[model samples]
Target: MTVSVLLFIILAIGAAGYALGVRRARAAAGGDTRKLHSLTGYHGQSVLLFSAVPALVLLGLWLVLQPLYLDHRAGAMIAVADIPEGGSLDLVLADVRRVAEGLDLLVASGGMTEDDLAAMGAADSDLKARLGGVGVALAGEVGEGVFEAARDYRHATHGLSLAMAAATIAAALAGLVFALRRIGTDYRARNVSEGFVLLLFIASSLVAVLTTVGIVASLLIESIHFFRLYPARDFLFSLTWNPQFRGGSDLGIWPLLWGTLYVSFVALLFAVPVGLLSAIYLSEYASRRLRALAKPAIEVLAGIPTIVYGLFALVTVGPFLRDWFAQPLGLGSGSSSVMTAGLVMGIMLIPFVSSLSDDIINAVPQSLRDGSYGLGATQSETVRQVILPAALPGIVGAVLLAASRAIGETMIVVMGAGAAAKLDLNPFEAMTTITVKIVSQLTGDTEFASPETLVAFALGMALFVFTLGLNIVALYVVRKYREQYE
Candidate 1:
């Protein structure tokens, strides 16, 4: 049976366990629910949790570990001599899996019988053709050892799948029996069910923590590989940005870092003032009808995809800046430039800053504004002194969030700011950021062993560190202001 089918059966069993538990509890109480320590629904929930949770957890773990075990066993079957030159075991194993899947498909399609498959030898040159006919494309000729390994892999996988299904169902049934035996008037069903719920909540929280750790660990590991191949000092401080796949590449990060900061600075410079002003207007000055209509219309910008913003930058904003400002001012005459990306990114970030700041501004206590007004302060003065100071921390948070969005932006930078990594002061000059370079480096067929490919990880790690620093600074600012306001 398939995993999904097994899961469905287990769930069905749990549902039955729930009904049995409820009936048993009611019978023990002699149909008087007041005699029971917990509600009928609590008793039912306890049974469902017991029957399904452990079985589901086991199934998840089994699914994760089974592939590793099968891969190891199948890899062991392939002889060292069978591996092609300059190709790793991973690549060969991938081919083995494809071939195994093809064989399974062939049998399922009725093109091959179990007897025919058992009688077939690796010496058959037409094996590739037969596999191809079934829609499995191999990179090269399948070796004798690889063919044998594929067959073994397929057999092992099928056997283990059945075993997994049986074990999972058995676990569910065992839990169902245990839960049913425990059902009684004196049973603490609510407490037990609530404990399971607490565990689930804790697990849900851990997922985010675990995911963050995983990302950092992966980036750190790959970045270490890159640093070992390339000098850390050169990567950090060198005033150039170029990568040659062959060798002798100048893999400097300074240029990219400068461009990133420049573009983000311009974006924030534009977005912060406009967004903050818009927030202030909407929150403190606008009428109720205007606020309702304007807020959603402004926020609609945030819902638009970044690619669409990028196209707008490329086709409209970029050229306009190049013609009207750059050429006239003799700064630079490039359609794609730092100014182009920064402006478009600023426009894109408006909703993020405006919506968040508006919420924060509105959250300020009404009493503070009343007090300011009673003190003979005008509406504008009240906003400036009372509401603005009160909402400063949250406004800072919103701005920081917008800045982070600008820093991590890739599509706008690629489309508006052309991919020319350089240390130029002119905003009208084309430039690129770390994210764009990270994408470029990892594009196409890449070998992770090489420094060029590995550098993408290093770039990502750098970006992560920079963003972390920004978060830290924002936190410190928030805490400082929040104390005074409170």
Candidate 2:
């Protein structure tokens, strides 16, 4: 049976266990719930949790580990002589899996019987034509070693799946019996159930922490490999960015860093003032009707995808700037430039800054504003001195968050700002950021052993560090400001 079907059956069994557990608990209590240590529902829930949770955990582990085990077993069957020139073990294993899947499909489709499969030998049979007839296309005819391994893979996977099903069902049944036996009048079912739930919550929280650690560890390991193959100093300080898979490549960080900062700076220059001012007006002066209409309209900008904004930069904003501004001012006339991306990114970021700042500004105490007004300050003065001062930390935090968003932006940089890594002062010149290069370096059939491919990991680590620093600063500022007001 399929995993989904097995899961459904397990859940049904758990539901039945819950009913039985409730009946058992009432029987033990002489049908008087008042005599029990916990509520009737708790007894039922405890049984349900025991019957389902452990079995589901087993199922999840099996699903994750089964493929790795199959790959290891089947992969070992192929000899060194079976691997073609320039081919890796991973690629050969992929072929084996594909062939195994095709053979399964052939059997399911009634094109091949178990007897036919048993009688066929890889060295003397036309397996390719049979697979092709079933619409399972292979790059080439399967070799003897691969065909044998594919058969072994199919058998192993089928056996493992059956074992997993049997084990999970057995676990569910065992848990059901154990839980039912414990459903007595004096059993502390509520405490046990709540404690189990608390453990689950703790596990859920740890999942996020573990995910972050995994990301950092993977990047650090790959980056170490990259630095071993290529000089760390050249990667950190070199001005040029070029990657040649064959050999001698100048891998640099300066040009990409400069372009990233330049574009983000321009975006902030445009977004911060406009977003902050819009927030000020909406919070301090605008009527309720206007605020309601204007806030959602402004926030709609954030809902639009970044790629759409990139297209606007490419097709509309880029050309307009190149023709009317760049060419007339004697700057470069490229359609894709730093200005195009920055302007579009700024527009995209407006909602982030405006929405967050607006909320923070509105959160300022009304008492502060009233006190300022009673001290003979004008409305504008009251807002500036009382409300804004109270809200300053949050606004600053919002701007920094928006800045981080701009720095990490990729689609706008790719479409509006062309992929030319350089450190030119002219905003009209095309440039690229670290993210674009990370993608370019990792693209195509490049091997991970080379610096060109592994450099993507280094670029990723750099971006992570930069963004992490910004977040730290934002958090510190927010905390300091928040403490004073609170």
Candidate 3:
């Protein structure tokens, strides 16, 4: 049966069971109203929650794995001979891919004519269509082998969906049966039901734990490979960074780290002041109309794709800085120096800072603003003395978030920042970043088992650790500030 139909059956039973529980609880409590641990409503809530949570978790996990499983199984179904040769292999494969895409869209879009969907989903009603009506056409043209493979793929998809749907419905039904069996004189239905409500509370904690664990695991595995190629001391503290596999040489991380840090720092220098000022203007100074119009306009900066930013750096900003500030007063560095990337990165981070800081500024209590006004404080003094302090912790958190974003950002730095490995402070000279190196190492015709390719994972590990530390610190600071307010 389809998942929706099965779930509806389970839900029907659970609702009936919950109603029985509430009735039983009310009867037990009577008019004295002290017999049960909680009210009748709690009994109903518990039954509903107990019936749903486990089933929903199962459903969600299944959905996440479904695409991967389907793709792997489908691809494997096309053997070397069954797919034909040369150009025909390409054509048949393309046809199969199109059919798969159509099936996915059919499932997603949720409407179909019988003619479009007929043979494939006669395999199962769950599959609404196959692309180009090709599934049926394949039976003759490609012979028995290709036809058999197509049939197998269709069967596997149906089985997976059915299995997932069946499992979810079974859980929900089991919960309902348990609730019904317990519907007796003096059963603790209310307490049992409220325990189900606790599932939502548990979900938030699980998400945080899972995210931390997953990031740590990825970094740990990669770092292990990286340490294998380069010695611990040199990798961590060497003053030069050069990576090579073809000519044989030394690879030190210091130069890359230096470049990465310098560019990020420069980006932060520009982003913070502009972002903070923009937030203040929007939150305190602008009229509602002005805020409404301008907020989206500025946020448009963030929505502009990162590749577009990269192209803009390459075509415009990199050369502009080279000509304008870098070469002008002699304090200027080279055109594609630290200054170019830092400036562009700062522009990229402005939306992040402004949106976050604006929210923080708005969060300052109205009572504080009123108190300052009552004391006849001027607009500037009220905002300066009363408002900004209250919002300082959050604003600082926002800046750190922007900083972390700058560190992890790839395209602008890759395009604007030059690939030099110098440890100097001159903004005119070009510099490289950790991410750029990660990309370079991972790309080209390298074997997956080689040290050169494996080093990418190590660099990835370092990046993860760096960003994770910043995020944790920011989260802690923001939480402390919130608790004080509460």
Off by over 4 Å in 1: 483-486
Question: Model 2 off-target regions past 4 Å?
Answer: 135-141, 479-483
Whole-structure CA lDDT of model 1 = 0.93
Question: Mind giving the per-residue lDDT tens digits that candidate 1 earns over 1-486?
Answer: 777788899899899989988998999899999999999999999999889988999999999999999889978987888788888888889889998999999899999999989888768878988999988888777988888899999999999888888888899989988988898888999999999889989999999999999999999999999999999999998999889888999999999999999999999999999999999999989999999999999999999999999999999999999899999999998899999999999999999899999999998888888888999999988988788888999999999999999999999999999999999999999999999999999998877689999999999999999999999999999888884543
TM-scores of all predicted structures = 0.97, 0.96, 0.63
| Per-residue accuracy of model 3 over 24-59 as CA lDDT, tens digit each | 667766744466666677766666666776677777
Clashing pairs in 2: none
Q: Sorted by lDDT, highest first, which candidate order results?
A: 1, 2, 3
- What is the TM-score of candidate 1? 0.97
Using lDDT as the measure, the top candidate is 1
Local lDDT at 71 for model 1: 89
